[model samples]
Target: MAALRSREASGVPLAWLIEAVTAGFVDADVSTLLDEREERTARAALPPSFFGWLAAEARVAQAIVSDQNEGDSRVPYREVERAAARMLLEFAYRLMHDDPDRHFLDLPFRFAAPAARLGIESSLVIQAVRVTERRWVDQLLTAAGERAGDIAHSVLSASAAIYDAVVDSFVTDYVVAQAQLDGEMLATKRALIDALLKPGVRDAKGFDDLGIDLSGHHVAVVLWHPTAGIGPHLDTAARQIGMSAFANAVTVVPGDDRTLWIWLTFADDPPPAVLERVRSIPRDPGRVGVAIGPVARGVQGFRRSHLLAREYAAVAGRLPPGIAPDIADTERMSYLSLLLRDPERAEWFVATELGALATGAVSDRENRETLRLYLETGQSLADTAERLRIHRNTVVYRLKRIEQAIGRPIASRRHELYAAALLAHLLEQSES
Candidate 1:
């Protein structure tokens, strides 16, 4: 039955075969359904080099990836001679199945486990996957005969979408595994601090090593989580999400047990999504204050960004207790951080920008709060009403009051920037 299916699928694109299976038009009988004889023949067709030779090629490929890594990363590649051969055989099986019902990724993560232990960049692990895929296709072309016609047909015709999904999962697994490896607690807090602060303070060692990626761009995150029952570790939550999102190790160090300092490093400028995560974190009731540093590189970049995140945390710390957890603008937080760094200066700026409305009095503060929410709701009257749980007419009333007091149209660009600055000041205020 399986052999009959394989014969019928001979020249069909893998996509169409998979679609037929998915659409319920065919029974994929993937688990041992395929003709065993044909599967064996396909695997047998590959040259000896595609298996044993594959390891040699992987070694060279891993070397190139290692060489291209950050200049200061002294990590060395572990040998994969035996493992690469296993991966080749596995790849051959995956290629021959070409049937959606029987399709499984069969990527060689276990083969790379040795290199993974050496602290090589996860990206390097991904590079090996590409190299393996390319090698498989090359061998397929050279050796394709009647037996491999289906394998050749699918692999060649729709290489892009087919391999994209494979690589995505492969890369996702590599980073998740790296996170699991690093999830084990690191060295003492004081030791990590000293290492990060003073680069040359004694020889660097494992876990104790300057864990920061000196040349990588980073988005530093700080979580000021509540210390009550053994609720979820905010640090762990951040690490898992960061690993999944950025596909790399996001350093999570305890700033004491109640506080966590995390850094997500990237090879280049982060996408908007990364910044949004940083901004959106430290959610409600948690007093989460997040600030992302500008993209920077090297040792200076590491310290500078950490300093910004820490400073951002301090600014959040000063917020009136129970202030909604929120992120200060990454772009604006640069100077705003400086202003809020000193209470008196922040007060002065608030008083200057907000004028009479800057006083911390209840009525003035309420007006300020409305403006903050009003801006946050994207200046939409309906959203502000819904968010504040007040009638839409109440929002209109508040906006009118606010504009009358501030003496400027809320829609003006200048007033908008001022309103943001005013909120920054309010974030630093302690609720009396």
Candidate 2:
């Protein structure tokens, strides 16, 4: 017993005893076996009570360890403490049972003193149970922290990828939408031009539609943009010049910021003073030019005049920004230069013979109708008379009147007269 106690106190291996219990070694009585071994060692090394107490506590701890491994029961703190206390009481009995000098009650106190020296308290068994739980909780917290960090990293990466994709999509969509808007704007501009440039659009009804009273109109004004602000400035000037009642105007946006095309018609030959009024219109920051076109009834005659005005404006390049150029001034020379191969000789003839009449006695309105009828009839007198709903004699009279006014006979100078008639008609219609 004394030898067994020394070995147990020194923390010797006790697995054999536990194995003996597990293998059903019934003959291995723990107390009897230790008693037999006591004779071979120093008996006074430990009191019998202390040896018994140590052995009992070892047995209880083994049972708890076995229960935990088997997963069959939970070792509560209180139950562990109760089992340890029972073992201590058994030890006191074993030691004091043979002691005559000390009362049995004193042995328990003596054993407790030594138990405290071994760091065993009434609450120690409870603390041992809690130590296991603490270790488990620490391991769980470590794993959670690692997993949380990994999840956060994944989320951040995903968010960055999603943000980039969204931005790319937004840019693509914006470009597509802008292109669509530009296409629509272009379509609108084409529609406006078609409506304004079509033949006969400037008829009496056309004038009325534009809020003009064209009952007696005989001439028109055509303005072009040479720079920015020309359109707005011309609009203001037109209104100031009684544009609302006496004239009808249309503005065509040519998609060039530097240019605008405007057409204006007058109830009668505009006073010569109105030219200066036109000249005084505010200029753009850059150069601008204006050209007058002959005015005639409705939009039919107005188209040719407007076109001629643009042509003259381009060729002369003489009008200062905001200044109006005399259409009559460019008509004779510009037309002769364009239509005749011998421009210089033709211009000379016009200047010498027909200049006064071309610029004077041929009222823009009548001359435009005469040429229009002539052209529509393919230059045939009978056809012109029938188209004009007049007698052939009446057509002959008008042709004679045209010849006299032009100071040349149409029959003698077929090509020259035809070209002159066309140019004169264009100028007359524009001026009207």
Candidate 3:
């Protein structure tokens, strides 16, 4: 990139090129290339906001060249893309004026840092630049006519130099900014995560810098692989989850080589169907496990959601690789999560409350599930029978057996039995 800059510095100054292109040399009749009629035609061909239109076209072209449209549904210009396009347009117009910025080639530098922060690859910027250059060349050719050869030699040379300088600036800035992020931003994010986990730790400016809106609803998620390097898969999974939930924005923080903590922000809580879609990520390749927290609102929601996800992760992490659910969520696991917080006490409680019903025998498993459903359905035997697809008498028989194993009537300790049954089920799942 520096080589490109050095090469440009050694060539005809950009201001001189601009003077020659617009004012024309004494020998070349290039000034008359775009006569009044041709100018009107050119103006008619483009809308009033030609630069804006060109910027949008460049965005599309960049997306195609970057292969961002293949399976990804995100808009190409979602990042600091508009800024990049503006920089490109500014560069072109500056080339037509005599007083180009002393740091004209560094125009891309202003937007590059922000683009890099947004994870925009340098290649995409180069693609946009190439698109803008091509369009400019087409316009130049249309106006060239008989002076085509002279215009091509002079104007094309200047445009190529400008293109090279801008490309170098973007490439250079992205490299520096990304490197800085890898070192500094990682620590900053970790600090931010730590602060967010604690109560009453709010940094408005810091949250703004990281693009997190504390006022919006948030769903926290943790993705991990017990024995594999998460690598880029974590980011890809985060994107899939965000898109599925129709999140307005996503923020991901790498917790370690094997884990990523993510937050998806939305204007309001997504419907149940969207959450189901988020949970379906296990079907995708990579053997990644997702633990999602319930949707909550405001700063409290952000903190609560993340805390719940971490709790869910603790339980989900107990499952053997490939045995973890695609999505382990607080909605389904919060009760068990509380029980499992102290594994030893939880085990003793399960054993004592469930008695012989906690045994691994198939009969006991059936009895335990029947009792659990009986309690969950508001102690309605009919509802339990319907769910288990058994006759009401069968549910009655199971209840009797469950009571016999526990040495008490089911109604004597319904809530205790319910909690123990849930913990027993979780323990069974872990063992399996």
Candidate 4:
């Protein structure tokens, strides 16, 4: 009856062969055709050729089974399953043939372990092989198939990150280079302004280029040390004062460590309030001097205004430390009026005003010192002599020579001409 069932279930005439082999291991009392139908059930589930293949592959001489009476041993079902899965995977690799671009053994095989343990080893192995083949086919199909929206999204995200990094680097480099280039450009512009606005640089429409309309404005000049921090501070402060008050103003071209200049135009006669506002800005540690020129128009007019401002500032009283000197402070220096039009003209005036005294006969250095002492002493003959440590008679003789060279009577024009000559001499010394 067991043999009949095995034949019916397995459709293999040999399904009862394993039963016969197991019968020899069990005594009649222990086993009587034990569950042949069950045995057929398990074998029917396996591939038809699986047992044969296993028999051919097994290296051991004797068959192993789970039968205590016969001393035959059974391996765990899991072990058999693992072996079968591995074998089938190997077979698939051979079938596909090795190709550099293809991956035949990629999928994880551990999942087939349970199926093998259920005595369905051949089916699990074959299924695993089919799974690996399907994966390869899917990969190829994706390449040749319709575009996946997700792929484009992933590519765009990566590209965006790369682009951001590249742009950030480029901007950083550009800023550094721009900073250096800007400094150089500023220096060049300052030099050009200095030359064109100087006491003597051939004048042209340069002021027009600077955005100044000389026709309708009163110009004033301010000079300071470029390195003193006063220039930038003044600029910042002035800019904060609202544009209406200084619509067409021009900052001075920075000179060396000691000098800088600015030109300002007021629509109306600058009120005391405006002047005071400008004067109020803190100055550098030294005596901060400023010059205000009479209002002038055009480039030539601006040049004149610059000179006058400089003259006024120079003759002004000893400026308080950190306080800018202004033109109003120098009202006492009457001689500065001569140079109020042009510094170059003042220079010429010095040569002419001192005439013979300016000649090669008298050392200009000695004469200038004598004049300074004379002025300091309030032009008193006795006091002038005392300061120079010379006899009064000698002072008298020098004064006469001075009067001769100047082509004027010291006693008559003493108040006017002497004052002019004295201021010119002072300016010459200060400049030197």
Best-fitting candidate, measured by TM-score? Answer: 3
Whole-model lDDT values for every prediction: 0.55, 0.44, 0.68, 0.46
Q: How many clashing pairs in candidate 4?
A: 3
TM-score-sorted candidate list, best first: 3, 1, 4, 2
Stretch of 10 with least lDDT, candidate 3: 24-33
Considering every candidate listed, which one attains the maximal lDDT?
3
Model 3 ranges with Cα > 4 A deviation: 1-177, 202-206, 267-277, 280-286, 320-325, 356-399
Q: Candidate 2 on 256-283: residue-level lDDT in tens?
A: 4533445555656557666456545555
Residue lDDT tens for model 4, 1-432: 565366537554322323322332322210111135422543444333433433332211112212211332333433333333333323322222322223333323232333333333343334333343344234323432343343333323322333333234334544555566556656766766666667665455554445545554545545554235555655554443324345356554554454556667655566666655555555542445555566566566667777666665554533233222233323433344444446666667657656655543446545655765776677787888878898888877777767666666665655544555555555544554
lDDT for residue 388 in candidate 1, whole number 0-100: 76
Model 4 residue runs over 4 Å out of place are 1-171, 174-208, 226-245, 266-272, 284-287, 311-334, 337-432
Q: How many steric clashes does model 2 contain? A: 20
Q: Any runs in candidate 2 off by more than 4 Å, and if so which? A: 1-196, 199-257, 267-269, 279-286, 318-432
- Two-way lDDT contest, 3 vs 4, winner: 3
Query: Per-residue lDDT for 169 in model 3?
Result: 71
